[model samples]
Target: MPSAHTKSPRAASRTPLIEVTKLSKVYVNDAVETPVLFDIDLRVQSGEFMAIMGPSGSGKSTLMHILGFLDRPTHGKYRFLGKDTAGRTDDELAIIRATKVSFVFQAFHLLPRATVLENVMLPLLYHPTIPSAERQHRAQAAINAVGLFERTNFLTSQLSGGQKQRTAIARSLVTEPQVIFADEPTGNLDSVSGIQVMGALEKLHASGHTIILVTHERSTAEFADRIVHILDGRIASDSRSHSRRSSSGLTSLK
Candidate 1:
């Protein structure tokens, strides 16, 4: 396991966009306490592509939850863009998540009755700072980026599996967040669809978006620059790849 203080010389010299120290999470039910994560320490530089991989019950999901700010840790500290998240209130966390983080899931999670454009515009509903016209413009751009501009008027249910997932990706990207947390993004798609989705993600990574992917698939993990393997609530390995540059000059493992 890598310690916060033991970063490689290359890593030590860089400023981290996301940092976690001694992170742990425990679930308790009826006085039965089970720890889902141990003392995990991690640092992700801006625009880095990372994959968090593990077998079932290895606490990868728990770690993802923590990383996404969807769940709090039992102990340890999280700092985002140099701000400590340890004592932040739920409202504060929500604000941070809304402005800084975006999420992609295996399930499209689109509103079945909504058009592709409308679904992509969902995040803007919570952002009072963006004017309606700007929201629409950004939404259209995101949809276009995902190659779904032609289907913007079609309901999510009218699309094929890959198209639906593409719409979902557009929605996540609509926010223009600093970080994207994706959990099994290709799990529900066929091989071809998965490849298309991965290609889309690769484009985003190239555009300097920080991405953290949670997956069990080796092939999927290979898309990232760095791979962090977890097991039994602990980190097993953190490996880097050779092809380390994204299109935007973002570092990748391989």
Candidate 2:
């Protein structure tokens, strides 16, 4: 019999944006093996906001890395946008990473000396095919999307924690990627600033961006349409959120 992680016929009817089956990861040092993930199966549809929640050392970040194409699983299968990724070369993976997926880490990785516009435009520098004028236009649009158009000229070092995060988000958006992985996006911000960052993410989701967020805070996880709980290197629960979303706004759980 096929494992539970295998995609069902019904699920196979519609193409998933991301898929994983019986995925596992392990690290070996001096012949000592330490396992981090075990027998994981998951799927994400386009334009869906999904959150993976777990405490530190629960393997949530490792799962995110695998899903984001930053790291490969030691065993099992991973498919991105319907393409199996098992034997893809590093250059091929880099191309997919550059064109299909974007990531935002807890620590803002912006260049301190660069202006917000310049930082946001960094991703486009990799694609020489895109004209300089088009690159600037996309960068400006992304900055505006994150509500940072006015601060485009401000140096990243001069920005607040919240503003820095928004700039990072803008950088992710400059690529117009199909999938975005955010690892503890609000981890370093104050409550108010975190709310602002969440609001930006929510707006992005509303506009049809597929978002996969990893967070420890229930309040932050509540923003996603679905939440998956991870425990001891395995999936504990996966459920759709009941939070209300209307034209007015999201009505989070009390």
Worst 10 residues of 1 by lDDT: 245-254
Q: Total clashing residue pairs per candidate?
A: 4, 0
Predicted structure 1: lDDT = 0.84
- For this target, which candidate reaches the highest TM-score against the unseen true structure? 2
lDDT of 2 by residue, 1-254 (tens): 21222223454466788889999999899999999999999988777788999999999999999998889999999988888999888987788788888988899899989999999999888754667789889999999999998899999999999999999999988888998899999999987678778888888988989899999888888888888899889999988767723322432421
Model 1 spans with C-alpha error above 4 angstroms: 1-14, 242-254
> Which residue pairs show collisions in model 2?
none
Candidate 2 regions exceeding 4 Å error are: 1-12, 244-254
Q: Scored by Cα lDDT, where does model 2 land?
A: 0.86
lDDT of candidates 1 onward, in order = 0.84, 0.86
> What tens digits encode model 1's per-residue C-alpha lDDT throughout 143-199?
999898899999999999889888888988988898998889899998767777887
RMSD of each: 4.7, 4.0
